[model samples]
Target: MDIFEKVKEIVSEKLHISPERITLESNFKKDFEADSIDLFELVMTMEEAFDVELDDDAVVGIETVADVVHYLQEKM
Candidate 1:
């Protein structure tokens, strides 16, 4: 699957939410109600899935699904 699809899958699995509900504009904290720990776990999942090192500072700027997708795309 592509990075966007993989991201949606990871977010859906971690947040226990449907993939359809996770849109580009959906904010991790506001839309999915993810806390700091949730975000951290999500980042770790992405790191493992993509085999890349995502810095804590970069993760901090990820607010929406689009943000994560864009970041992963750039990193990859």
Candidate 2:
């Protein structure tokens, strides 16, 4: 699967939401009501899934699904 698809899968599983509910513009906090711990787990899961180490600085700027896709795109 592509980055977004992979991300959607991870987010769906992590948040216990449907993949159809996720979009690039969906905000983790606003849309999913995800707290810091949720974000942290998502980050850690993404790291393992994508096989990349996400720095704190980079992760801080990630608010939407698009941000994660972009970051992974740039990193890969």
Candidate 3:
């Protein structure tokens, strides 16, 4: 799957939301009501699934689903 598809899968599974609800414009906090812990778990799960290390500082700017996809695409 592509980066967006992969990210959508991970976020949907972690947040227990419908994959259809997760779009490029979807915000983790505003759209999904994700707390810090939820974001953390999502990041960690993405790291494991994508086989990459996400720096704490780097994760700060990741507010939307597209942000995560872009970040992971760059890293991978």
Candidate 4:
């Protein structure tokens, strides 16, 4: 799968949401009810899945799945 699909899968698994419900417009707080720990776990999960450690700047700016995809694509 492509980066976007992989990201969606990660988010879906982490957040316990359907892939259809996760969109570019989906907000983690407002839409998914994800708390701070959820985001933290997501970061660690993404790091494991992609086999890359995130820097402070990359971790701080990720506000959406698209941001994660862009960050991973850049790193890869």
Candidate 5:
């Protein structure tokens, strides 16, 4: 799967949402209704899935799925 699709899987599993509800433009809080704890797990899951180290500053700017994909592409 592509980066975005992988990300959608991660988020969908964490948020317990259907995959169809996730979109590139979907916001974590607004669209997925993720709590702060959920975001924490999501970040860690993304880091592990991508096999990359994510800094606190990097996590701070990650507000959407597209943002995570773009950042992961850059890291790769």
Candidate 6:
């Protein structure tokens, strides 16, 4: 799967939501109602899935699904 699809899958599983509900513009806090713990867990899961290390500073700026996809794309 592409980065976006993979991200949606991860987010879906982590948040217990349908992948269809996720979009590039979806915000973790506003859209998913995800708190810091949720975002942290999602980031950890993404790190494992994509095999990339993400610094806390880098992760802080990733508020949207598109941000995660772009970060992974740039990292990879």
| lDDT tens per residue, model 2, 1-76 | 8999999999999999899999999999999999999999999999999999999999998999999999999888
The list of candidate 3 runs beyond 4 A from truth reads none
State model 3's lDDT: 0.94
Measured with C-alpha atoms, the lDDT of residue 40 in candidate 6 is 92
- The residue pairs that clash in candidate 6, if any, are none
Please list the C-alpha lDDT of all candidates, in the order they appear: 0.93, 0.97, 0.94, 0.85, 0.88, 0.94
Clashes of each: 0, 0, 0, 0, 0, 0
lDDT of 1 by residue, 2-69 (tens): 88889999999999999999888999999999999999999999999999999788898989999999
Give stretches of model 4 more than 4 Å off: none
- The TM-scores, one per candidate, come to 0.96, 0.98, 0.97, 0.88, 0.93, 0.97
Question: Candidate 5 at 2: error in angstroms?
Answer: 1.1
Where does model 6 exceed 4 Å of error? none
If ranked by lDDT, best first, what sequence of candidates would result? Answer: 2, 6, 3, 1, 5, 4
RMSD of 4: 1.2
Instruction: Write one digit per residue (lDDT tens) for candidate 3, span 1-76.
Output: 9999989999989999999888999999999999999999999999999999998999998999989988998898
lDDT of 6 by residue, 29-66 (tens): 99999999999999999999999999889999999999
Against the true structure, candidate 2 reaches a TM-score of 0.98
Kindly state the number of residue pairs that clash in model 3: 0
lDDT tens per residue, model 5, 4-32? 99999999998999999888888898887
Off by over 4 Å in 2: none
* Residue pair clashes in candidate 1: none
Q: Give the alpha carbon lDDT tens digit for every residue of 1-76 in model 4.
A: 8878888998999999999988866777778998889989988988898988888777877787777888999888
Give the better candidate number (2 or 6) by TM-score.
2
